[model samples]
Target: MADVRSMCAIGKHGQLGLNGKLPWEGTRAREFREDVQRFFEMTKGHVLLCGPRTRRSIPQFAYADRTIFEIRSSMPPAETIAMFPNRVIYIGGGPPVWSAYASFIRHWDITRLPYDGEADRFFDPAWLCGVRNGN
Candidate 1:
């Protein structure tokens, strides 16, 4: 079986996003660019699982060569993972996706940037508790 992983870049305040875009979008920070590069590098050739909102945010050809599955409310997270047993699956989204699939992620890569910004969305540390106990 392949591994399920999560890669996220947050701000000093645990800010993940604001207004559907990255909180540090206009900050001209090297960390954000590096993080984005790392994400693309790591997720290359891997399956991506994201919710509808995340799917819509991505450009039409952004991940055209790779498999990007739109997670549906009717499908159980476990069942979705099972569909791609031989390939690494990366959970790509914000809090909602993380909260729903926390127990299935085998590894979590979180990068904290030096940005102090306003963000309506944040990454909750408590989400990892399910990963610790469930698997």
Candidate 2:
């Protein structure tokens, strides 16, 4: 596998999103927005393995700079890792995709946001339960 990595912004209790969107919906969150921009900037020159949900949520202007691959059941995570040999590959999916590819991911960069609200999506608990190749 290549330098496979993942990134996520979680709430106080690991809340990822609510209804396919960021948890901070009603209220404005400048920090979260800045962090998201940081995500785009940092992964600009890298490969992003994004599923349908993630691919749709991306900003329109971002498509011009980064290299994003729509990964689904047809193309397994392992196959994507194999396709990129010595480059960085960022997994830009939610809990399900992250859980499915946890073992193959080398690093996880999780940011804790200061939002306390109900969320339908959350960070994978398994990631914290077990040690990966590197934390």
Candidate 3:
């Protein structure tokens, strides 16, 4: 089996996106991007998955083979399991996708940004995931 991981950009108020975009700048934003890049590099050959919106959110994902799952509630779990059966999957999404697959996820790489703004898409605090603040 392959390793599984996920990443997302959240703003100060646990918001994931504002106007369909992440709101972080300067060092925080750069550091988040760099951390994601490192994750992609470390799992170069594995699959990186996300919903359509999440895929759209990322402006320029450097990985050549990033895979989009485009999650559908009607889809069966077996089908989801089949897509990345033996490899680690990294999901970068806003909310819908995160809620859908949180139970199956093994690890989370969340970035804590200053909560000075709001996001239409907010990350659920119920997940209770700890942050490994990146650079």
Candidate 4:
């Protein structure tokens, strides 16, 4: 079985997005680049799964050397895993995609931002607690 992992940056209130973008806009460009570079390095030579909208939201240069597996709502986690049985798989996107594959995830790398901002999308507090408790 492939090792499944995920990562996301959330706010104090579990906010993940606002108006289709991150709620905060004050992050330095270099910081963003370093974060992206780290993610790419972590999942290098493997598959990264994300929804079409999330995929489109990312800058093209960010994925120049990585293989992205565009996820559809109807695609089963088993099917996606089967496609990359010998590789590490990283899933990073919005709530729907996360919920769909949550059961298959073996590890999560969640970053809590220092401040809360207005958001229409959020990570579930219950889920985060459960994961932290190793439920």
Candidate 5:
């Protein structure tokens, strides 16, 4: 079986999003771009699993060198994971999708942004600690 991983940027307070977009307007757009490029480089030639909303949020050009599995709310994570054995699958998205696949994920790549902002969505700190503790 492949190793399932999750990646995302979060605020100090665990905020992931605000009003359907990233909460922070990065002072340096290039740095943000570099971060995104690095993410692609790290996950290069691997499959990425994301929900519809996250998929739509991404620009069309961003999919150039990667394969993406669009996971619907109704899909079973185990079934999806089973479909990609011996591969590295990166899960990128919001809380619900994270919760759905939390049990199967073996690693997490969370980027902690420098500042905090108002947010409507958050990544649970407890979940991060649990994953780190191998719960």
Candidate 6:
């Protein structure tokens, strides 16, 4: 397997979204994009694997030589990672997608937003628990 990585923009309460949009400002977005871009640049231009929602959520600045794939079934990730082991995956969406790929992800550049108290979406508890327990 290649160096599989994961990225996300999370809030203080482990929230992922609010009203179908990000919970951060442009500066935070730029910072996340810069980190991702730098990571890919150093890794020989690895593709950013993401779902359709995530692909659309991305701004123009975050665009790179990416290969966007939708999460239709459970077989694709293994296949994708097999083809591009040096993967820089970005998990941005509802809880399901985040939980599915959180384990394989090696790195995360999470953005800490102020307490919005309005985030309706969250990452899967199982994943978080696993990480907390060092599974």
Best by TM-score: 1
Tens digit per residue, CA lDDT, model 3, 1-135: 345567665666676666766655344556666755675665566666666666676556544656545566577534675677767677556566566656566777776655576557777865435222221
Off by over 4 Å in 4: 29-37, 125-135
Model 2, residue 115: distance off in Å is: 0.7
Residue 13's C-alpha lDDT in candidate 5?
A: 88
> RMSD for each model, in Å, please?
3.0, 3.5, 5.8, 3.9, 3.5, 4.9
- How does residue 81 of candidate 5 score in lDDT? 84
Q: Residue 88 in candidate 4 has what lDDT?
A: 80
Residue 74 in candidate 3, Cα distance off native in Å: 2.7
Whole-model lDDT per candidate: 0.80, 0.78, 0.61, 0.73, 0.75, 0.55
lDDT tens digits, residue span 11-91, model 1 = 898988888887887666677788877777888788989888777766666585668889976788888899998899989
lDDT of 2 by residue, 54-135 (tens): 7887778887877788888567667778887877899887666776678777788888889888999877667744333221
Q: Considering only N, C-alpha and C atoms within 3 Å, which residue pairs clash in candidate 1? A: none
Error of 5 at 87 (Å): 1.7
Q: In model 1, state the lDDT of residue 72.
A: 74
Which model is ahead, 3 or 4, in terms of lDDT?
4
- For candidate 4, the 10 contiguous residues with the lowest summed lDDT are 126-135
Ranking by lDDT, best first? 1, 2, 5, 4, 3, 6
Better of 4 and 6 by lDDT: 4
* For model 2, the run of ten residues with the poorest summed lDDT: 126-135
lDDT string, candidate 6, 25-98, tens digits: 34355665664456455434456665555557666654556555556445555665676544555544445555
| Model 5 weakest 10-residue run by lDDT | 126-135
TM-score of 6: 0.63
Tell me the lDDT of model 2 at 125.
Answer: 62
